[model samples]
Target: MKFISWNVNGLRAVVKKDFAEIFQKLDADFFCIQETKMQEGQLKLDLPGYRQYFNYAERKGYSGTAIFAKDEPLTVSYGIQAPEFDHEGRAITLEYPNFYLVTSYVPNSGAKLKRLDFRMGWDKAFHAYLNQLDSHKPVILCGDLNVAHHEIDLKNPQSNHHNAGFTDEERQSFTKLLDQGFMDTFRHFYPDKEDIYSWWSYRFHSRDRNAGWRIDYFVTSKRLADHISDSKILTDIFGSDHCPVELLTNTL
Candidate 1:
C-alpha cells in the first residue's frame, strides 16, 4: 500500500495552493498530514473515498495532525495518552488489522533552544509510547519530527549545529528512537544521498537554493523494513515550507 505524509504547515493555506490537485494525483491508500493548524468545521476537504481523522490543538491555529485513509481503521486514537502533550493535538494513531499508523508533529526545540527541556521530555515519553505500540504489532509512524538526525540530513550542518533542530540533544533523541528498532525509511533507501530535504526556511531564498532540512520522516518498526518498497522525498511540491515524504510498503 502507499502511504504519504506531509507537513502542510497550514491546511487552510495549502488548500488554495494546488493541494487539491496534488491530493487527487497522489491517490494514496493513506494520506497523513501534520501541522494542520485548524480545528474541525473551520474547513472541509472533499477527499472522496477517504475517511478522515483529525486532532486539533486546544490553542487556536497551532499544532495539529490529521489523517485521510481510503480504508477505515479498526480504532482511532487522538494522542499517546500523555495529557500534558495531548493538549497540543500533536498526535494521532490509527489502528489497522496489521499495524498501527501514527502521525505526529513533534515539538520543536524553539529558538535558542528555549524549549529544549520540554522537547526532551516529549521525546522520552514518545519513545516509550512507540515501544509500547511495537510490543503489540509493527508501527508505521510519520510526520515532521522537527529534528535533523544527522549532519547529512541538513544542508548547513556546521552553522545549524546549535540551532533548534540540529542541537545535540535533539539529534540524540532521534538516535535513541532509531536504536529502539525504528527504521527511518528514507535513510534506509538513500543512506548517502545529500541535498534532498523536506522542510526549508522561508527566509534566505532557502527553497531556491535547496537549503533545506529533512526533518520529516516515515519510520516503521525494524521488522517491517524488509517490506519497504520505496521511501522518497517529494521536495518539488510546495504549498508550505515543508514538502511531502512517501513510503510504499507491503506490510500495510
Candidate 2:
C-alpha cells in the first residue's frame, strides 16, 4: 500500500495551494499529515474514500496531526501516555489488522536550544511508546521527526552542528531509535544519496535553492523492512516549506 507523510506547514494554507490536486495525484492508501496548525472546525477536507482522524493542540493554530486512511482502522488512539504530550496533539496512532501506524509532529528543540531538554525528554518517552506498540505488533512511524539523523541527512553538517534540529544530542536520539530495532526506510533504500531533504528553512530562499533537511521520515520496525517497496522524497511539490515523503510497503 502507498503510505505518504507530509508536514503541510498549515492545513488551511495548503488547501489554497492546490493541495487537492496533489492529494488526488498521490492517491495514497494511507495519508498522514503533521503540523496542521488548526483546530476542530477550522477547516474541513472532503476526501471521500478515506477515514479521517485528527488530533488538535489545545492552543489554536499550533501543532497538530491527522490521518486519512483508505481502510478504517480497528482502533484509533491519541498520544502515547502523557496528558501533557497529548495536549499538544503531536501524535495519532491508528491500529489496523496487521500493524499500528503512528503519525507524529515531533516537537522542535527551538532555534536557540531553549527546548532542548524538553526535546530530549520527548525522545525518550516517544521511543518507549514505540517499543510498547512494537511489543504488540510492528509499528510504522511517519511524519516530520524534526531532526536530521546524521551529517548525511542535512545539507551543511558542520554549520548546523549546534542548531536545534542538527545537534549531536538530537541526532543521537534518532540513532538510539534505529538501534532499538527501527529502520529509516529512505536511508535503507538510498544510503549513499546526498542533498535530498524534506523540510527547508523559510528564510534565505532555502527551498528554492534546495538547501534543506531530511527531518521528515518513514520509519518502521526492523522486522517490516523486508516489505518496504519504495521510499521517495517529493521535492518538486510546492505548498509548505516541507515536501511530502512516501513509503510503499506490503505490510500496510
Candidate 3:
C-alpha cells in the first residue's frame, strides 16, 4: 500500500495550480491533506475512485484536514477527542482492518511563541490520542507535524534554534511522542541523509536555496517498521510550500 501526505496550505488555492494533475499522477491508495483552509460547502472535488473525508474547521478559511482513500475505511473519525483542541479540524483518522491511519495539521507555536503554551498542551493531548489508538492497533500517522525533530531536520538550525518549529520545547515534545513506541519512518530509513526537506519559507528564495525543514512526516508504530518499504520526501513535486511525504508498505 502507498500513502502520501501533503500540506497543501489551502485546498481551494492548490486546485487552481496543477493539483489535479499531481493528484492523478501520484494516485496513492491513501492521500492525506493538511491545512485545507476551507469550510463545508466551499468546494467540491470530482475524484471518481476515492472516498473523500473532510474535517472542516468551525472558523472558515482556517485550519482543516481531509483524506482521500481508494478503499473505504471501516470507520472514520475527526479530531483528537479533546474538545478544546478539536475546533480547528486539525486531525482525521481512518480505521482499516489492520491498522489505523491518522493525519494531522499540528498547531504552530506562532510568531514570538505566543501560542507555545497551547501547542504544548496540544502535543500532550495528541500523543495521548495516538497512544490510545495504538493500543487498539498499530498506527500509520502522517501530515505536517509542524516540528523539525532534530538539528539535522532544518537547513539553518543554529540560527533558528529558538524559532517556533525549532524550539527546544517543541522538539522535546516530539521526541517524547516518538519515545512512546512510534517511529519516524523517513529518518528510520535514512538516518544520515542531509539537506532534504519537505517545507520551505516563501521569503528569501528559501525553496530555491533548499533552505527548508523536514516538518512533514510518515510515522508508524515501531512494530510496523518491517512492513514499510520506503519513506521519502517528494521534493521535486510542487504546488505548495510543503512537498508530499510518502510511505510504501507491504500489504498489512
- Candidate 2's residue-wise lDDT over 90-169, tens digit each? 99999988899999999999979999998898889999999999999999999999999888888888999999898889
lDDT of 3 by residue, 1-252 (tens): 899999999999999999999999998999999999998988999999999999999998999999999998999999999999999999999999999999999999999999999999999999999999999999999999999999999999999999999999999999998999999999999999999999999999999999999999999999999999999999999989999999999998
lDDT winner, 2 or 3? 3
Report lDDT per candidate.
0.93, 0.93, 0.96
* Model 1 alpha-carbon miss at residue 152, Å: 0.6
Scanning candidate 1 in windows of ten residues, the lowest lDDT window is 243-252
Runs off by more than 4 Å, candidate 1: none
Per-residue lDDT, model 2, residue 129, is 97
Q: In model 2, how large is the Cα lDDT of residue 68?
A: 96
Compared with the true structure, the alpha-carbon lDDT of candidate 3 equals 0.96
- TM-score winner among the candidates? 3
TM-score of each: 0.98, 0.98, 0.99
Model 1 steric clash pairs: none
Off by over 4 Å in 3: none
